[model samples]
Target: KISNEITQFTFPFDNDVWSIPVHRDNSYYESTYKKSPMSKTDTINTPATFETKDKLFVAIHEAALTDFASMTLLKAKGNQYKSDLVPWRDGVKVYAQTPFNTPWRTIIVGTKPGDLVTSTLMLNLNEPSKIEDTSWIEPSKYIGIWWGMHLETFTWGQGPKHGATTANTKRYIDFAAEHGLDGVLVEGWNVGWDGDWTADGSSFSFTKPYSDFDLDEITSYAKKKNVRLIGHHETAGAAKHYESQLEEAFKLYNSKGVNAVKTGYVNKYLDKKEWHDGQYGVRHYRKVVETAAKYKIMIDNHEPVKGTGLQRTYPNLMTQEGARGQEYNAWSNDGGNTPEYLNTILFTRMLAGPLDYTPGNFGFDYKLPQGAKVQTTLAAQLALYVVLFSPLQMASDLPENYVGKPEFKFIKEVPCIWADTKPLDSKIGGYNTIARKDWNSENWYLGAITNDEARD
Candidate 1:
C-alpha cells in the first residue's frame, strides 16, 4: 500500500534557499524552480540538482516506478522539514508489494552542465540493441508535402489543390531524385481528412486511400525515380483507433516497399482522460515501434512521448517531434521560435534523443497566414542542418523556393548521420557551436547560432 508520511531527508548542503525542477508535461516550458502545487501524475522522475559557483553540481536520480511517482522540494528549518506540496493527496495512490525491484536512486556529481551533456550515463542504463540485422536502416535526406499544408497553400483534404495528390507526390519524387534525396513524405493521401478526426477520433481509415491518390501509381512512380516513399499516419490523437489498425496498416506499407513511417498524434486523448506522457500514451508509442519493427518499418513520431533512451533498444525508432518544431514558424502567432530556442534545446530536449525539427526553410522573410515571421536569417537556417541531429532529415521548404539559392547546396550535401560530434561551444539559451564528422564520408560540418544578437 502507498503511504503519505512526511519523510525528511538531509543533504550535505545546508542552504535554505534551493532551486528545484518540478516535473510537468514534457511539452510545457519548465525552467524556473518554485515551491508550488503539483499532481503526482504530472511530476517527473528526474531529480532537481544543486549547483555551486565552482562548477560542482549534485543531482538526485530516482528509481523508475511502474506506479505514479511524484516529488516536491522541501527546505528544512533546522535538521528536519514537512511536506506541504500535496496536489495529488486525494488522487490515485500507487501500491507495491515486497520483492519489487525499484529503480536506482543515483546521485550524479558533475563538474558542469556540459559534462552532464556529454555523459553516457543514460545510454549505459539502457539495454543493448535488439535488432541484430540493421543493414536496412539507413540515414536519409527527405522532402515532403507537409509545409504547404501548414502554410494554407493547399488543403489536407481533397480539393482543387490537395497537397498529397498523385501528381503533387510525383513532383516531390522528381525533386528528391534530382537532388539525390533518399525519401519523399506524402501526407493526407488517406480518406480521413474530410471528417473531424482531431476531435471525434473515429474519422481516419489507414488502409483506405483518397479517390484522388492512386497508391500503386505513386509507389511505382517513386520506385522509378529511386526514391523511397515515407508513409504518413496522422492519428489526430486517436491512439485507440490507430492501435486497432496497426497490423493491417503496416502490412500495406511493407507490401508497397515503404520502409519508414512518420506517425503523428497531434491532438489529445479521444477519451479526454490521459496526457501524452502518461502510462497509457507511453505504452501506445512503444506498441507502434514494436509493431513497425515487425514489418521492417522505421518510425518518426510527431507529438510523441518524451524520448527516454528507447532508441538504444529499438533502432527502428528513427526520430521524433517531441519539442516545438519547424511547423511553428509556418502557423504560430507568436512570431515563430526565437534564435535562442534551438540553442537551448541542443542541451535540454536533444539530450534525450534525436529530433525531427525539419530545418531547411529558405524563405526567412516569408510571412505566415497568422502574421508571424521566421526570426532567423538564411544563414542560421543552414546552420540547423548540422546542429540538429536526426537520422531522418527533411529539406522542409518547397522545391520552387530553393531555386537559384546557393544555401540549398548545403542541404543537399549535409549528412543526416554522424560518425562523431564535438560541441565547440554551448551556453544555455545564449549561443551554441557544434562540429560533426559525417558517418559515411570523411567530410566535416560546423553549425553555430547566437541568441538574438549577431555573433562574430
Candidate 2:
C-alpha cells in the first residue's frame, strides 16, 4: 500500500499516455505507445524507470538493501503499467526456512519526473551508516590505463603494448600527482588477464602481481607521490573463485595502502550457473562490500547489481556500473550508445544511487580499431563530468589523449563528489541540465546535454 498523500500522484499507463517514446536506456525507443510495448511478453529488468506526462515512476527491487538480488519486472498491462516481483528468474529452487526474511519489492513514486534526479527515497529507506568513522571514505577524480585498452592501443595481457606495467603505472601516478587527481587505477596488473580472462576467472590471483607490474614498488611510489593506488579485481564473473580469495586478497591491498578497489564481474552468469542478479550473487556482492570495509577499503563495482542506497549504509560502497555507460560508445557490438543515452538514465537508473560512468574521453579525432566511432560530440563529453554523479569519477581516456587540449581543463577542475546538487531542467531522453556544488569548495559546476540531434 502507498501513502494516501501520493495516491493521486499515481498515474499509470492508462489512456493518459502520450505519443512519447519509452526508454529502457537511451538506445531503447522501440516500445512507445505508438506501437504498444505490451504487444509481446517483454519483461524489463529491475531498477528501471518509466516516464509519464508529468510523473516519474521508478521500478526498483529490494528498496531496503539486502542479500537478495530479486528481479522486479515492469510491464504495461490492463491499461496501466504493472510490476511483478519474483525471487529468481533463473528457475532455481530457492530453499529458505520459514524464519528467513524476503527482499523488499518496491517502486519510488516521483511527484514529478525530476524527482528521479533529486529524491533520495531508496537511500532514505535504508539503515543509517554502519561505518562509524567515515573520514577515510573520501571522494576524488582519477585517470587510468583503462581507456587505451578499450581502444586497442594497449592490451590487458603482457607484451610490448600491455597497458598495465611498472613504467606505465608510474607515469599515471606521476600524472595524478602533477594534476590534482587523488588516485590512479591500474587494471590488468595481476596475472590471469592473459588468454580468455572473461570465460573462466578461476586462475586470477588477488594477492599476486604479474612479473612486469611490480605491485610493491608501484604502491610505494604512489605513496611517496601523495597519490593513492586504486586496485582492480576483475572476476570476469567468476564469483565463486573470487569469493574464496576475498579475505586474504583484501588484506594484501590494505597492507599496501591501497584503500579503494574497482571490482568487475563481467560475465552473463556467476560460476556458469548462478545468475549474477539472483540471491546467490547478491550474497557474494554484499560479502565483498562488508569484507572490504573491515580493511578500510572502498569498492567500485562494475557489471553490478542495481544499487539501492546501500552506500548510505556503507559509505565505503562508493560507486557501481549497472547501466550501459560511456564505455559502450567507445566499443560495443552495435556501433555505440545513442546520443540520448546519458540523458535517459539521468531520470531512470540513476534514481537508485551513485554510478561509476567513467566519463571524459576526448578522443574524437582518434581512429578506433573497428569501424566503430564515438556517437556523441566533444562538448557532451565535457558536460558529462557535471551531469553524471559519482564520487569516484574517471578521466577514462588515455593519458596522451588529454595532453594540451582545451576541454581537458573542465575535466581537471570538476569535483567527483558534491555537497549539493540541483536539476535545472530536463526532458526525458531529450535533454538535461544540472548544477552541483563541490563538497570541499565554494565553487559550483553546471552541465547540460541533449540527444544526438539536439544541435549541429
By TM-score, the best candidate is 2
Give the range of the ten consecutive residues with the poorest summed lDDT in model 1: 33-42
Instruction: In candidate 1, list every pair of residues with a backbone clash.
Output: 63-103
How well is each residue in 243-359 modelled by candidate 2, as lDDT tens digits? Answer: 899999999999999999999987777777666656676778888999999999999988776687788878999998877766666677666667666677777667667878888
Tell me the lDDT of model 1 at 94. Answer: 34
TM-score on alpha carbons, each prediction: 0.84, 0.89
TM-score of 1: 0.84
Off by more than 4 A, model 1? 1-52, 56-113
Cand. 1 Cα-lDDT: 0.72
Task: Quote the positional error of residue 362 for candidate 2 in Å.
Answer: 1.0
Per-residue lDDT of candidate 1, residues 221-257 (tens digit): 9999999999999887888888999999999999999
